[model samples]
Target: MNCEKIKGKVSIRTVLESFNLFPVKENGKTGFYFALDREEKVPSLSVDYINNKAFDFGTGKNYDIISIVQQINKTSVSDALKYLEKFNFQPQEIDQKEEVRSNAKYEIIQVKEVKHPALVQYLKYRNVCDQIHFVKEIHYQINGKKFFGIGFLNDSGGYEIRNKYTKICLGKKDVTLLKSGMDCQREVKIFEGFFDFLTYRNIQRGANEVSDYLVLNSTAMLFKAEELMKKYNIISLFLDNDSNGRLITDKLFNQYNAVRDCASIYTGFNDLNEWFCSSGRYCDY
Candidate 1:
């Protein structure tokens, strides 16, 4: 696609999120993100969602979506467009409707085994196809339009649905707890998201099934797992390597006795799945 078409279809927020750069604070339609080039105590990049542009107060540099990608990837315009092509984009009108009714009602259409070719490919891409039993194919509707994603069910019957293009929660957001079927399970592994949990299972190759597993689905739901976490003698955290992950790890360390941060295993990567996919260990289970 041309630069204008890409700029029109993709949002500045989406590109930042793809690089794991999240806003430290948001005000109305504008978000204050950290400067992409350097580390700082406070955010100096102002991203305008409505206009899909970003301005860096630190360097006084302005960026549209394409330029943002170019800057972050340190690539030419052609390479940047190629990188942006991997993202799934919808029409501007649909994005506007989605933003306006983000909290609107949704209906679960169906839940079945992961069978669709697209979702299967997604699982393969994440290198978690061996753990397909842990997830399902979910079809849900929002604003009378139908969509499907690989669904990981939470304890509250809600689903953490994810596809190549979208990530959302259907029903009440909550945590997912998987017991080892042992009568006296005292160990639990905590993961920030289900994909990481699946990656762990895949890496272990079914050898580490003795302990219970808890997928937070989102770190924002950490509180929901606290009461359950109290019962475990060992709590191993497989959270991301981002600022939020470090903050949550520190919080849990202060609150619990045997909390272990396992992020060191995936040291330079953002999360476990990303590490697994890039570590040249994408072998079949």
Candidate 2:
């Protein structure tokens, strides 16, 4: 399983319990009793189940399951991740009510060519219509109500669903990989989301300017792209200017000497789509 899947699906309480370390309560809230620093009368490590996160009151350190695993075992990230895989914490199956609700909650009703005027305008609004023909219109239902969006399928068969009022993934999350018609292309281009890929296509205007494409959908999904990217002679990054973007770009930069950070081209914008919008119709994340 991928890091995001493990971090999200594995409960830290389960991890703590498996390690034979139990949490203690002081002020009526449940919390762990681990000592990250000097021991004290009150237990300092607290697990927040609502957020699926933890915090060390002593050191004022916040943690996710992966980080918590690293803390407990003093192990590296990859090792902690492997440690998590042994747990068999499959993503809990969508329970009965949820099965019904998920059926009702934007269940895909239909998918077809990008012919919706609203989605067409949404793309034109983002200035990415040059590649409009490649996208699809996804019609779904939630609570017996219907909705639609422009959809792009990623490598794992998940749809990156986006509309003016909403943005979400409809299935398993994964990166979108677009190959150069010829295999072993010397270079690849990276973007944080599919719109950025479309934005790049809109700017570059034709197939000649395009290289292989990797649309991460979420910056956190960068790890899934790392192995495939190593095959290229050059890698150009068009990630957002935000913290997540800078951090992942740094990780990619370290491993590949030939990787290039291309965000400088849209210096003040948060991302390629935002730059393309230029305060156009969609002001989004």
Model 2 poorest ten-residue lDDT run: 95-104
Cα lDDT computed for each candidate against the true fold: 0.78, 0.70
Question: What CA RMSD would you report for each candidate?
Answer: 14.5, 12.6
* Counted clashes in each candidate structure: 0, 1
Q: Compare the candidates by TM-score and give the number of the best one.
A: 1
- For each candidate, give its TM-score against the true structure: 0.65, 0.63
Residue 175 error, candidate 1, Å? 0.4
Instruction: Evaluate model 2: give its TM-score.
Output: 0.63
**Model 1 C-alpha lDDT per residue in residues 1-285, reported as the tens digit of each score:** 898887876556656755545576776489898787876667799999888899999999999987887777788999888766544322121221111112335799999999999999999999999999999999988768799999999887878788876666777666799998997767999998899999999889847467999998765456567668889899999999875578678878977889988999999998999999997766453
C-alpha RMSD in Å of predicted model 2 compared with the true structure? 12.6
Which residue runs does candidate 2 get wrong by more than 4 Å?
Answer: 1-106, 279-285
The 10-residue segment with the lowest total lDDT in model 1 = 92-101
